[model samples]
Target: MDELLDRTAEAAPQDLTDGAELRGSSFDFLTGPGIDLAAKAQAFHAWAQTRVAHGVFPYAKRLGGRPGATAELTLLDGRCHAGLNFSSQEYLSLARHPKVCAAAQAAMERYGVHSAGSTALAGNVEEATALEAELGELLRMPEVLLFPTGWAAGFGAIKGLVRETDHVVIDQLAHNCLHEGARASTPNIHLHRHLDADHVERLLKRVRQRDPHNGILVVTEGCFSMDADSPDLKRLQALAREHGALLMVDVAHDLGCLGPGGGGQLELQRMLGQVDLVMGSFSKTFASNGGFVASHDRAIKEYLRFYAAPNTFSNALSPVQVAIVRACLAIVRSSEGGERRERLMRAIQALRGALTEQGLTVLGHPSPIVPVMLGPDALARVASREMAQAGLLANLVEYPAVSLNSARLRMQVMADHTPALAQTAAHIVADALQRARALAGATH
Candidate 1:
């Protein structure tokens, strides 16, 4: 491995020459005299083309027209279709809710749309400040800092917290954002087996034995997005405390639907107070576009507010989004809100039970996110396409995103979906799987 790394490093500069022809070919098309912007553009285009050729190109198309499933999503050849939307992170289906929409409209009327500049450069909108304070109070944290996106939150937090000598311990199946953030910020990062508290403990012991002075940060997801499985947060938190390590929980998937008041897996396990840092995305449950990091320590929040690139460089959350999120939080905390939670849970249970009864290997517990383990990438893709044809939009997970051999159909159950709808979708998936298996056998 050392020799390979050395050789790769040696060849890094020379690798750029392989695309020299493509780079030079585009230079004449540019009218700019300075800045060598044409070279950068050519390199970017070359990389994009390579990704497309590899069948890994993402978001190459746009969704046009409406707000719901009938919207002309880019992948469906721009046709307006009403398939069940399983790919969206809008967990609560609050995006089109009348109350949420009305709140956003009201905010627009009162404060206009955009914040006009970065939050630090100009005083952030009052609505944004209120939302942050509300979130901090709801989460039982001292303070909270918001970012433009979840990626920014992850990146900025890791960059702000860790130093060169510090080490980060993360789950092997952690999100790309966390992995990238840790990699860019710290040199010593150890990825432990997914959801294995024992493995994390052992790694921490080894790191401490090697360098007792090394600052350690353990990272894991509250609920994994792909498998929909939650970690043993109580055990992990205990282990982190025992080892004098800080624990950071990424509650992106679980925050809206999991805990007593929708606080998340950590809160469900009574470990929220023990957790050192909690990060989440508002785009999912809040049905808004932004992310936040909460901590009991005010100093950490202040440090990230000033030092984190996401907080300083990016534009603050729109006033309209902030207002909508505040309204959503109010609804989520209301006494009547339990009905929506219960309804969604029942829908998830019905769908999961139906899929399991059909003899499909459903991953995780009966959570809102249900994944049917369809082996091989080709079969998963075929199943997804077939389900779309059958009036359901299930996502096909494959290489790089998940284990190459463990492709599956990732389906999310919404509160609006009735028991009948969930069962119908499950049957469609089962039928598609059987047909796919038969076709493969015949071809073989």
Candidate 2:
């Protein structure tokens, strides 16, 4: 609709080569030495506006209605089609559950659509209070704090609790919110190789050696979204204890989808109570848009409530969101939750096996998230486009999201997706990969 294929200018002669040809108009904006911020953004927008015609960018097709394992999607050319979806994070498929929907509708009738103000002022409804208590009980923590969004929770946790004198050590593959929070928390930041607890201990040791009394915080995810792998929480917790550093785990991807009672990866490893802090999102598993930070220490919880920017400034979760999350949480704690998780795992394994049987290199261990290693930016984009055209919708991750040469299709399997559906999607992806390889000049 907004000039999808119009390039801002003609390509330079030298820019018509291999890697150079793939460089969009942002090359000058990103790499040029003396360009002003405004000019760079304008140039990038001009380039991005034309990418729809190139069959890349604006990755997700517009959904005409409710999204599920299979849904109707509208392409850029206004062609509507039904597609098997592997791009959603609704692992339990609770978003569309009748009970959850009913709870939300009832809450909307009682409390309206908006929270009205920040929790610090007038936004702390009865539903919010009840949800917080439930989460606290679930985590076996003394205190729990909520935020409007998971991103805000992570950002606020580090910024609110860690001082300028603190040293932060985070997993290299931690989510962007954690990275941003660490950057804002302190200048003394260290990164450890993903899932490498030894590296984390070494960083912690180095920090302790340098600043004997400075507080140290270690952050990692329970399940990484891109790789679909989880660290050994027991080992990480031991490292933190030996180094006298606090460990914080973000269980956004694993909680409510793994372990007994859906306690998350940490609970599966028997390190739930040992970790100093736990934060997670309700959006992924609980089918609601909110986040919580829980800890055994009441002081930290109070401090966050008083100082966290989100708690202090952002509006709290609406009653409807809280109600749906509460309903989903109940389901996650029920026997049906286990059955759904089993289905989710079966779907993941089925798809993984299918992709591998097709001679595609699938990355990571058995998890709801699966990534097919496509390699190179161009190949990944082409494969994604072809796959979309073939009626399978998956997410393509390239440079910036991942390494330049490690571009991939990040596929997520939901409980509602049948094994047959997964296998069919895999076939489509395999066919798309072949086309993409031939297009990118790869043979075999």
Best by TM-score: 2
Q: Per-residue lDDT for 72-163 in model 1, tens only?
A: 34441232224555556556667788898899999999988667467667848888888888887767886888888888898889888888
Show the lowest summed lDDT stretch of 10 residues, model 2.
7-16
What is each predicted model's overall lDDT from 0 to 1?
0.73, 0.81
Error of 1 at 58 (Å): 9.6
Superposition TM-score, candidate 2 onto the true structure: 0.91
Which residue runs of candidate 1 sit more than 4 Å off their true CA positions?
Answer: 1-76, 441-444
Candidate 2: tens digits of C-alpha lDDT, residues 395-428 = 8887777866788899988999899988998899
For every candidate structure, what is the RMSD over all alpha carbons to the true structure, in angstroms?
A: 10.7, 5.0
lDDT of 1 at 415: 64
Screening candidate 1 with a backbone cut-off below 3 angstroms (N, C-alpha, C), the clashing residue pairs are: none
